[model samples]
Target: MAALHELPSQMRAVYLREYNKPYELVTVDVPNIRENELLVEVHAAGFCHSDLQVIHGQFGTKLPIIPSHEPAGVIVQIGSKCSGPWKVGDRVGVLNFKNACAKCVGCSLSQKRYRNLDPRFCDNRETAGFQHDGAFAQYLAADPATTVLLPSSLSFEQAAPLMCAGATVWGALEKATSGLEPGATVAIVGIGGLGHLGVQFAKALGFTTIALDSRQAGRDLATEVPGGLGPDLVLDSTASDAAEKVLAFTKGEGVAAAVVCTDSIVANTWTLRLLRVGGVMVPLGLPPDRWQFDADVLVFRELVIRGSYVSSAESTRRMMEAVGRSGVRSHITTVELDDVPGIVDMYQEKNFRGRLVVKMRD
Candidate 1:
């Protein structure tokens, strides 16, 4: 963890030395599992925007760590301490935030607020692929605390993205659900990778959903929602009268919730305009700089802003159920494990929707 132990001049290699460099194919031993860990034969791993930030040193994560946090696979081995129903050869999906230390504020049951939410906020947690090694390898040491049994109906390729991207948006939607009545209107802004899934989640929850995005492809993806689950409508967020259209569609009351999946401050600003009085807004994207909002929108309309929250275990199971029922799926572009470098470049250069995943095996 300390800069690869300050390699000597003769041993210093060009890559795998630090962040902002290409990852090399390093032959390391298969990860070993601890008492609470499960040795997962990773069938698939997902690429997230945060993975990009980690590589760029934005999160200040421990350097020289295996990246890609989303892993869906079969359990090849389980530690003796893992006494749940989990067993060898069982299909599974792991949440990135694992190895929860129960005493921390984030993990303590008394901290009801954080208890059901992400464990990544726990001060002492060891996040796979972030604070330490991750799922990019053939086998990852996964914690049972954050691992969920993948539904038999779901394939590993699709299940991998659900581990993060799917759970994240679902978490936001769950927050939005608490603040609304049954079948309220909700708006999903920015229909890219996260937004596309957001649209399905909103629809599956029976909300009168609206999909918004400037990109034609994003708008199109909304209509092409898997299993025909719909947002009910798709509107270009960039239109001059976009807010007006949404307000009129909602009978001037505006949507009950607006989930902003894009990182653009300008686009996020537009979402505030679509919210009715007391409407909640959940922004999932983490932009580099702080978000700027008009104080008047918050004060006058009494609009509420919230972050995504739900028990890592609970959210994964609920998301799996939704996937099973409504057939929600990721529009993933998968690359073999060895071709991750190419996927990294594609994520940066290509304007694509949904997730980029690594297929660890055939």
Candidate 2:
């Protein structure tokens, strides 16, 4: 089409190719958009640990796919069937879900907690970076329904992680800290990307937050990084009496709620133990293996352990607005798309800190 011809015939992109192998950079045709899709010129894509999993064959994603779901870009073309308030030249961010059928049970129920749990949605869902070709490229076609408008004050680099990191933690925090009055105690059990953002959100929401990490380095990150103003209390997760310390910090009643963002089973369990009776624990991380949770504490204390999946489209929109209003942002180290392979290696060795975002175009 003449509209498509106005754009480049081919664009640079990275391909997964083989499992546990270096991603290959190659030129590929600009994606053609469906009637309900928007062709976005990606400016930046956030490098998430989930992308690392796709590289390591851990997630078993369809191979030879482009990975990196947290992308922010400008719309270059709009499809005929695409509706809503979006238009060309609009800045937008793509969420984890490519599309969700409105007729699904999840949509009908309209329960935010079950946003990603409904089989009707989950069974047919296409997850960017996990199920669909993601944003590790120059251009991508995204469903307008799943994309949200970016705040004018936010740069692409900052807005990119909101697509996943920000949205996921926001959903978890809303669930974990619901009905928590100001000055209420809340714990974030992981000072990495997700935990760090959780701290910012908790603080912004007026909670007396505690930062927890297994290592000194992560604790320092929680305190030093921008948007990671050290919480009221910092706890050593590896300490033998870590849970006891949390209990003591909250006047022996334990935290009103905690959001566990670590994939470590022990960390998840520790946070669960750190909750007060009837307290809420929202687990957002994907652990490597199935864990046998403590049923004794569950039944005795009547504690609630809720599982949080990626996030609903509505959560993503609200997160962007909150981030813009609250001035909460991630500490991102920008790299070019060409450095994606090296970034993957850095992730594998756990060498990088904060979050990495690829500047797809200058």
Q: Please report the candidate that would top lDDT against the real structure.
A: 2
User: What lDDT is obtained when candidate 1 is compared to the true structure?
Assistant: 0.80
Residue range 1-362, candidate 1, lDDT tens digits: 11112222221111234888777666566665688678778888888888877878887877677888889988877787885778788899988877767677666653576445345667788877677778887778787778899888899999998888888889888887685787899999988778888899998888999999999988988887676687787898888988888988999999999889988989887788788899999998777789988899889999888976433677779889888888888788888766776666888764676788888878
Q: What are the per-model C-alpha RMSD values against the true structure?
A: 5.7, 2.7
lDDT of 2 by residue, 287-309 (tens): 76996579998889999988777
Pairs with backbone N, CA or C atoms under 3 Å apart (clashes), candidate 2: none
Q: Which 10 consecutive positions of candidate 1 have the poorest summed lDDT?
A: 6-15
In model 1, where do residues sit more than 4 Å from their true spots? 1-16, 109-111, 114-118, 309-311
lDDT of every model, 2 decimals: 0.80, 0.82
Number of the top-ranking candidate, with TM-score as the measure: 2
Q: After aligning candidate 2 to the native by TM-score, how far in Å is the CA of 165 from where it should be?
A: 1.3
